[model samples]
Target: MKFLFKTDYEDDIRLFPHSGYLWTYGTLLVLIAAAPFVLSSYLISQLVFVSIYAIVGVALLILTGFTGQASLGHAAFLAIGAYTTAYLQQFGVPFPVYFLTAGLLTGIIGAIVGFPALRLHGIYLVIATISFALIVEEILARWESVTHGNEGLRVKTIQMLGTTVPRDSAGFYYLCMGVLIVVILGAINLLRSPTGRAFVAIRDSETAAKSMGINVSLYKVKSFAISAAITGLAGCLFAHKLTFISPEMFTLQLSIEFIMVILIGGAFSLHGAVLGAIFIVMVDPFLTFLKDDIPGAIANFSMLMGAGAERAAAIEKSTAAVASANGLKGAIYGFLIMAFILFEPLGLYGRWLKIKLFFQLFPLYKRATFKRQKIYVKSERNR
Candidate 1:
């Protein structure tokens, strides 16, 4: 077991707690830098997706994790950022200008959304956000003049430093990786600052935060703006990656997946955001495997059980039917979300801490060190 005896105030907010963090984070950075050269193009593209989603996860982390605000319509912010980028591209704006503008616009919108959320909490907040998302979707569909309706907008290659950069090129991948790094660094600094600490206080107990003279409403709005800004930046890259933009792409389902990313990856940690992104991006491939292989396997199993040919065929057909349902994907996501809430409330990041502790403590470890208290309270309001 390693122990650190803090001797200075800087120790409390230092970026690297110890040398171990430097080694681990350094290795991770090195790998990210080398990935483009070693990985296949398809996998590289997936990494791009992961980076973008992870950015949004961090945004949600700021609002939902650190500040205890609930939003179910973050996809609206994403769509705004994406469409903003698409719209600006046609005007010949440089990448930096439009990119920052996308985030700024999204942040302003998020702050506006936060105003309505002030009186809401729990499920009500969720519903309000969902309504906002539906409104954005409808606007996107009806405002044919600018959005081009459901026909979508084509995103040409990005021009950086007066050079055309294709989506698959290493330049774009590095750009995303670089952005993720900057966002992570910025979030770390923010968490160590007064604003970040205020957010945490409000999350833990709004009433108590109010007692401390913290402006709960203002902080909540700030949190939303900051979170939305980060997500908007991610949207810029997302639009570029797909080379297309449409209202249908940023649906409620996508917003739910963002929630899933934070929940499953570790709601409280930046590391969780990256892990959640990987899991979310890979879900499609996993579902594809189920769709393509599971039915055939079921048929073979029925044959092994000595079922008649027609019965085996029927069994396979029914199994395929279940797998083919449009709702199956959503159902699986829902189940995973529920399971994580029930079994691992701390998420993948929490699980990681537990495992690391076990290794560190070895035979001296106790299960209760990471155990949850089965306590329930009947409270009608935030603590």
Candidate 2:
């Protein structure tokens, strides 16, 4: 509902486009700060999970959404971080040292992978990344001396400035929240910088970005490193939260969930990452309701209506069977992803924008306000 008429070049570079953003985001921060105090301990842990996944979601957006480079092997980078931290812990390495090492190591590996991957695009690039993930999975399984093979490595509590912090404690919740805040701020600043602009350019068109004097190859590699580094930090938190590390933990499905986080959250938005994380974290409970609670509710209703016990029981059994069928959860998630791709490509955040704009414009709004345009040429910018 708000409009800004830019009169100066500085206006475009402002951190918040309008006063509304400042007020709304400020309110959000206050709520997040009070979450630990007001929410249950288990829910606080869920918040920690959301924070960690949000980090990974933002990283994926940096590479796939902004840089125009697609990746399916992000789980490998995540594994590298977890294993690096676990390995370093054996030597009693400090938190800062191990954390930095995890990020740097993953970044270097990502850079290595990005160079060869630059030659590939679209589905080929996806395949290449998935191949990388498979390779990392194999190495983790084979490298028994370092990764402990199939046996999981237990992660101890966080060692912060010499204090041991439990993962579920309020202090740890604060730590995770703090890290998420920093990462979001850093991402916001990055997107505002020239480097981030270059990423957007490359994503729109590598040939055009190169024509414009941007080092496409260099920026692409940098995007990979930056994205990988962010995911690495998430891995550290994820490992600690799970209290275990194994090759099976960082599977292709896990990497797909990271993509799901970005897709459902809004691939091109920083806020999307956080929203997607929240959605992903809450999905387990939702799936449980669908699988277990729905059947029970139906049974109760049927019995209340004086239906025979046999019929009610049969109905419940059939409903439970269908809901609990193997791959139903994945199928539902995949269907939703497909639906979004087909009907709401811009994602949840995009849908929110459209709805808000419709209400603001009332009868004046047109269907074309948020319509998607087909690109005839990949080298041309639609943004």
Clashes found in each candidate (C-alpha, N, C closer than 3 A): 0, 0
| Angstrom error at residue 306, model 1 | 8.8
TM-score, one value per model: 0.93, 0.95
lDDT of 2 by residue, 128-220 (tens): 999999999999999999999999798888888768889899888888888888888898899889999999999887779899999988998
Model 1, 1-383: lDDT tens digits are: 78988999899899999999999999999999999999999889989999999999999999999999878888999999999999999999999999999999999998988887898888888999999999999999989999999999998889989788799998999999999999999999999999999999999999999999999999998998999999889999999999999999989999999999999998889999999999999888788878889998999998999998899999889998988889988899989999999999889999899998889988888978877778787675742
**Model 2: residue 55 alpha-carbon error in angstroms:** 0.4
Q: State the displacement of the C-alpha of residue 265, model 2, in Å, after optimal TM-score superposition.
A: 1.3
**Winning candidate number (lDDT):** 1
Candidate 1 RMSD to the correct structure: 2.3
Positional deviation of residue 64's Cα in model 1 after best superposition, in angstroms:
0.3
